[model samples]
Target: MILCSSTPHSSPETQPSGLYSWPNVFHVPKFTYEAEFELQQRNIEFETNGTYFNPGPKLKGNLLDGLAQEMMKYTNYPKDYQCEEVAAALTRAHPCLGQLGSKTGFWGWKQSLKYKMQNYRTKLRRLGHPEIRVNSLKHKREGQGKAAANIKKARKAEVNYIPLHPKGETIESLENERIALLSEVKKRDNEVLIKAKMENTFYLRRLEIVEQRPMIGEFKNRWPALFEESEVNAEFLRITTKPLQSKFMSQFDQFSDKLIHILKKKGGVKGQRIKNVLAIKDLCDDIDTRRECILKSVAIYLNEDPDSFFKEYLASATEDAERDISSTVMGIYIIRIDRNREPEDVGVVIEGLKVLKNVGSIILGFIMLFGLIYALDLSFPENFKYTFKFCQKIVMNLDGHKLNTKIQQLKIKLFA
Candidate 1:
């Protein structure tokens, strides 16, 4: 159930079994994993929401991160999420605590990805393409479409629903075609966007009357007939020759339509000062549905520490390699799981093998075709090597909760 905000305030999505009074308790062991997965989902929502408050300077990297996390932590939040002493210290350290400057241009690539994808979606919506969506031109559309269909199918299957594939056809071919369509759309959209970016830069110059004055004034002095003429494009050139106008491409609709009218009427208007820019959360929306599968994967691995022959499970694999490994893992793992097979029965295993007979003969054959990369080899980049080390450190710290006290002290000192 969705807890929508629009109605007469819908309740939270989970209707408690209400057998016992403890609302925090998980009725199913897997439900606890869902709670952890919510951490990432909530973080995405909170980040988008934070863009609502203020896009200020002066807020430390860690402080901004903390505020985002805290906002997600409590549905209702206190003013000073930091303790009294720490809050006092922070203010004393930077006397003008609430003061801020312009939006710090989006930072870290890790953080940049969420916002960039949001920006991409917003630009599309502004261009009146709200009905359709695509990530980027870099992928194949038919392939993405097919994968999306299969993912939807699998999710439905999780709800105890099974799909009947087309007569004499397999799900695999459908997945590939769907993926190809999505990729094609993504490429076409981006090709158009590049042109829009260049056009936006030229359009922005019309914002400043004084800056535009010199160019329009020169035209009036020289070819007054042309400046006075009804040709809109010619007059627009005079308006946009100004050197000081800023390129704020996000407001292209208002900018373009207004410019066309002004050019036609030989009139001008001043640019308005912006008070807010609402956070766009489209990328976050796409990932929201995937949270269920991610949580399931996390839960299965958390307790069991899954075993397998190949050692390239999760060792900071390169993205290019990760793609191949992910496919190989998907194909192999699904084959291994044999979900339809009952315990103490090999019949389903035989049936599945029979169905898969013409596909890659063995796991090793599939891995070889995919060109599996040894994740721990010297070929791994330094950053990925460090990432593995960092994960190891975190795991070590998790094994000792006392390490959290040290972490707390480090955070306090860093914030101070």
Candidate 2:
């Protein structure tokens, strides 16, 4: 018998809306009380309800299967930290369910949940669930030979990461819709229709992205409407459930002051250089200037060349000079409208192509390009990979617990 449905125990006021609420750290499965009552009816012997007790292999399997089913409702590929959170919540709600001889008493359960989730996905794949089926071994390229490295699961907290087509909508139907959207975007005052059609064809878009892994230029050509400012923000919202520009800028602002102070405390030649960057006139007065200074300081702190990621060129620079800027990988270009005045625009260049132009500020350009990177599944530039990863794991808090050594060190100092 399915003892309990897999819904979460979220209050109406606390329930998330849209795509962006952070995953509740304390997710309790629905019907907790019912499950506890059933356990009591089983006449299990234990010193106390809060004490650890083995539910026997059969009962344990049933309970775990139920939990796995509940979790699969959210994501088939839960990150390690997500599994830990769910397991910890489960054991905390019913301590008797906790395993003895484990550090947190839920370590074993966490492992079981991971395995159970995998098994559940396997079953779904067999049944041809589009989302899971796409990642099946049979679909893998020839000579991959069981390496699982190329699995195209959601890396961020994407709610509709790889959804099935909308009801009654098949691939051909969605393709037709997508083609219609291309012309619709060119029409004036068609934002409403464009938005609806984009939503309708999301499944098809994701299938192509994951299956084909098209080049950035090719993907942009195929989905030209997706690169518009409004749609860029919209697509980001679809993927992460957060407003792209606001979330990034707010997080950057929140940490900017503290990050500067932390960098100031370092004692070395690089530290002096970072201080010099910070000492620029009106750095604190102008938000753009401050943001630029902070970015430069961070690169200096991390021992990376700021010039590698950021470039400045006169608006009337020679064709060869313009060509050099276009060839930059994951680069931000500051176009100086005049030598004596502030830059007129910032452009984001990815894979030697200008993907975003007329961006108002450096930080905004960074976030928008980051959104594009996620949307297009493009790899981060090698020189600044950790920096982007820092923003992904720390600022955005998606898969926040998994951090590399460099990001961990920076995070400690930023938070300390």
Candidate 3:
């Protein structure tokens, strides 16, 4: 008689449908369920060339019971099985599988192995054995986390990775250094352009002032308010006087004195323009009374309306000045007066000063002050007061008696 162990390696075809083939020899073990599981974990072939797991002879009787007894020596008492731990233990049992890591076919053999373990757990429940489930929920969550990590990596890869510069790009060069260098270059270029423009403007303004200098000097000589006295003298002293074209400096030397006499005769206190005026005996009283009288007459001459004049002149001058400023300056940057504030505006102040210098009338000065205070509603009353006070001091510094007589005579001539 022969004895053979039954294991997963044993099958009817492989065993030849009879008793064990090893009758006189030591019996070989048959294939068992545990050995089959072990083979799957090791990814080894169970059958090859129409043979069982063991291609040699069939095993002896009841190999499954013997293998179970042998396995009990190293097996844990509880025997809780998780997918990876069981895979690791099986690989430990058979070192040949360790090099291959755990081989599954195409789609991940671990998933299929997990289903098998679930079924095994179900069987244990049916057998009235308490369930020994290993915690694989955390491992599943980690797998999902890995999938999410891959998705994030793919998203990051979708961004444009080409370098802006000619050289090969690093992360710092592509992201930070490129922008910083380009921006610095652009800013430096803009600054250079602005500096060039400012230098050009400065030279242009200097040229204009130099060209207009001769003409402006003549105006300053005739119109004292147009320039400071020291500036006028300094400019005029540098100018070389031209020689007389005629063959006589003596001829024109007395010409000015003679002309002054002739002008004095035609235009004097006794002229027809001042025929209604009388000389003042008391200088102080006449100055006080005549100042008021002259102002009233001048107001009548202006039609007693200064607002219209201020508005008309201010608007025109402001418009012209603003246009000139806008045309000369480039870009959005500018220096300008706010014309909406009317006479309080600096443009209006410029026009006023020019008009005052040309008018040369003390009465007109008062009128302008009134218009600025009342019509234009300039809020600076104290400034106006101080300005008029200064003018009054200047007037008081003059020969009051002579000035009073001349003003009275001039008013009568102008109004008559």
Candidate 4:
């Protein structure tokens, strides 16, 4: 069924059913939607084997065997039938033309037929069929052969030059001092802050590259099959079409439903009142999966990476909140804990809850706890407002004190 240039030739013992190699007949590659529509408007009839071709009678072998064998008769113009007329006749005889749901589907069918017909033509041309004109000048195009020869001669005549160094100094030795300095620079450039200072040009270029990264590029890289474009007609068919299929659009709908459910949930309050906190943690884990799926759906819809979409949303929301809004709804509490804190450290505290034995459950428990705090802030604005303000001041003073202590310690070290 699938036809390509790489397809192997059929063996003599297992030859294809009625595959004929005819001469002076070309396959129609651009027989597209417009051609089909024009043919339909003309309403032409197809004649095969001295009678009208019918799709009703099932062909013994392949569905297109009759068309491929008889197509040359119409194309050769024995009765002076024009190309359009031949196309109309061929379209009328096509088994699946009517079954095609849209113009694109019809065009795709025509393209497939065209490839099959081309393969047949190529097979015949290989057997020295005189009437079929194979392009003998493929490797000898006008001025190309002579230009290639000239390039080859130039390459043969060209000389290699090596830079001369002193007898004691080899190329590597000569560059050793510079290489050492370059290695040091490279080492310094490994960290982000140092790289920004040491390699300003490259750091700025990196920022620009990140900023200009296309949403479509991300989708294509992540889901290549879904976003892949046909090499032949990519401009018209793939690039021009948006929301490529119902499946893609359905993802957006599912995501919207998830967001709506999140907004409408009263389960958070009920789960909070439960004697067991593990039950609430399990629910949050499921909700997290739904949230992740929603993000993926949005990423596909916008033709962007999920990370980029999240970053852009956060940036825009922050901008809007700063520009128009006077206050923030969400409060962030930053607690300085051991940088090397392990899961086992939290496991002891959650042992009483009895629900978070595993590392995953413990992580989910923390997520639920934060989510509960956020939900309560929305529900009880009066209570959390003053509490958050006090916490904010406390954090500010703690940071200032920490900085002052560090400065005092540095002064003592320097003076001593």
Candidate 5:
């Protein structure tokens, strides 16, 4: 009668698209097959304790059924079948078995499953849907297209007993194991610790995005900011995104540090020793394409957002009148108000007009056209095309050269 559940909780991970990852959020080590085997071994070591799982029948992968057979290996399941009491014990023992080995910790699989289900239900209720239970695979699409809405309503009106979902249990166990392994590795690996902490940081930002715009309009406005931030959030991204440049940098630093350490230990390495060091140095140089990548990124980012930021130095302040945003500002404007697109895209306006009266570009003609297009889209004061062309008529002495396909592609993809 004892029904054990084998659900363990998992930690959350932030997805790239800014979704919250709510995983199986708990741990239960004792319900695993290994834990049962250990418990059986422990009972024999204690001499007086009754036998544990595996003597009577083999497991069928179902934790509850397995626990039933495990109990009956030496004891009678019918006699021992007290679901509630046994479930409570499994709940208490599962965590300990995970921390200390199963032999010292002790829990039955059947009871563990039930306890896990109870814990899962408790968590789901905490998430605000008390009536909504984990959906079992067999029952997932159930009652959807059925003409039994009234029956479903009646079931809801009465006390309904929802079956525990096997997948949910599996998810929970997997989560617990993954987080436990991560925690164990963290003690020995700096990289794992860095990744774990970075994951938390990323999740916090994702939650912030959810708060700002759960709706489409808000998301459209806010998504750009998230995209921009993701570029520089952590070192792994920085190094990889910057590509072979960072790899070479790391290799160089490591080799230099090693060489210095070796030299300090012994004054100098000559002949064969020098050759070994040179080989390492050459290996280090092989990963050095990072500088070229850095130059390209610098050219692009600094060109587009000239006043924003650079890896070398803090970006020049927008207030610095002498700063050159001619290319960047024009690029922003062209993108936002090209071919009768809205002048009312306030982000583009702010970015374009950030420097106000100082746009010195060969494409200043394009800027005039851009403002006119925005005006036409907004029905502002005048016809933008006519006004700009008329102004061109008076000043530049040019007949007709407007933003065409080649210009559009260039302006949007790369800052001219």
Candidate 6:
């Protein structure tokens, strides 16, 4: 096997308090029915309270092997931290499985799972599995020695980041499916077929993304269907197993009232500026306007100019309008489609390219664009980094555990 680094890779520290204490949308993975049946046959007694399960103490080798096999269905290369998370989840579900006298209570299981996963990968490598075979020693570079560079693994809670293709489908065949999808997407009433083809070619798409690292524009051109609003939502769901727009909007609405109240009470120049932004006539009359105000308030609270984050231009302006908008890493480009009235259409620009156009509302545009960022593994723009970070860490509760000082202080005030 191509051994990457012997050293355990460091992950973000889990925050112990503040908004980090909020519950996540991610439910712990449960044991398969077969596994649960075997446990029951082994006379393991357990209690189930909602989604949580508590089972008997002693688990044998066969059980661990089974669990590892199940995990391999999701990812062949589970990172060390992911293993720890699984072990933690396991102990949480089955308190009896906790290792005696261990600090986190599942240290032994974590180590055992790590080894089991390695052995499992070895078996697959021997069987010529494409995913595992790619990581064999023969594929290693001549001068890399024992440690491989640029390890590729899921960064966040991507459950299906690098999944295997469906049975009886090879990489070339999947590529052909992907190629056919390009034309299928252009036709109307083809949603079902398009979605099916997209799902079938997921492995191939991920391989190209992870290996080639194509630019946003290039990738969109090759996989035009993936950029459609529906496909973007579908892709995000496939990766994270959560409905992107619903979760984002629900959280935004849940906290917007409280956050607005908090922002309105600020004392200094920033407070005055936010007050002015909020004072816009009838700002609260429309949901979209209120959401836009909230976004502006958030930027001000974080000491960023909201205008820089959202640029507006006339549709009839010079041809250079799009060129100017493309300079930013990511932003909402409000286009005045009709000079006779308010701008009704907006475009979401990412990586100096317009990814989505004619977005109906500012809040929806932001949420959809943010979903695309997560789905495409794109970095948050530096200008609005904290703003987006706040959304990711707080609203979505994906990696909220570790908060920087600024956001942590804000969290304290918001929750205070």
User: Which residue segments of model 2 deviate by more than 4 Å?
Assistant: 1-22, 31-35, 41-51, 147-149, 281-284, 337-340
* lDDT preference between candidates 1 and 3, better one: 3
Q: Using lDDT as the measure, which candidate wins?
A: 2
Model 2: per-residue Cα lDDT over 140-226, one tens digit each? 888865727478777656665776556798889998998898899889999889988888888788889888788888987888888
In the range 1-416, model 4's lDDT, one tens digit per residue, is 11211122334335422223222333432233543454334334322222223333233124344344445432211121222233344444443333344453334334445655666656754763322322223423466544223111000000100011234544355345323333444363243433232222221222222223333334223222221112111211111121122322343344445333432332454323221322332344464434334433322322233322121113224445233222323222111133233223221011112111232322233232222222111121232332222111121111112123423432243234
Q: Which stretches of candidate 3 lie over 4 Å from their true place?
A: 1-397, 403-416
The residue-by-residue lDDT of candidate 1 on 1-416, one tens digit each, is 11111112112233211111111211111112333254335445545653222223333333433322222221111122112222333223223332234242222312422333344444643553311122223222456644123221111001101111233433455444433433433363353443332233221222121122333333223222221112122232222221111111222222333323322332122111010000111124432212212212222222212122222222233454345443332222223223232112111011112111222222222222111111001121221222222112231121111233433443243234
Ranking by TM-score: 2, 6, 5, 4, 3, 1
Better of 1 and 2 by lDDT: 2
TM-score comparison, 5 vs 6, better candidate = 6
* Better candidate number, 2 or 4, judged by TM-score: 2
Off by over 4 Å in 1: 1-177, 182-406
Shift in Å, residue 93, candidate 1: 36
C-alpha lDDT score of every prediction, in listed order: 0.25, 0.75, 0.28, 0.29, 0.30, 0.71
Q: What is the lDDT of residue 40 in candidate 2?
A: 59
* Per-residue lDDT of candidate 3, residues 1-416 (tens digit): 22333334443234321121112222323346655455554444423322223211232123223333222222212122223333343334333333333352211223433544444444533543211211122222345543123211101111111101223433344334323333433353354443332222322222223223333334323333213222222222111011111111233232323322332343443332222221221233533234433323232222232222223224446566455533321111112234333133222232223322222232333433332222111232331332222222222211111223434443244334
Per-residue CA lDDT of model 6 for 153-216, tens digit only, reads 5555565665555679987898899889989988999999999999888778877776567898
Clashing pairs in 4: 215-303
Alpha-carbon RMSD to native, per candidate: 30.4, 4.3, 45.9, 27.3, 24.3, 9.3
CA lDDT for candidate 6: 0.71
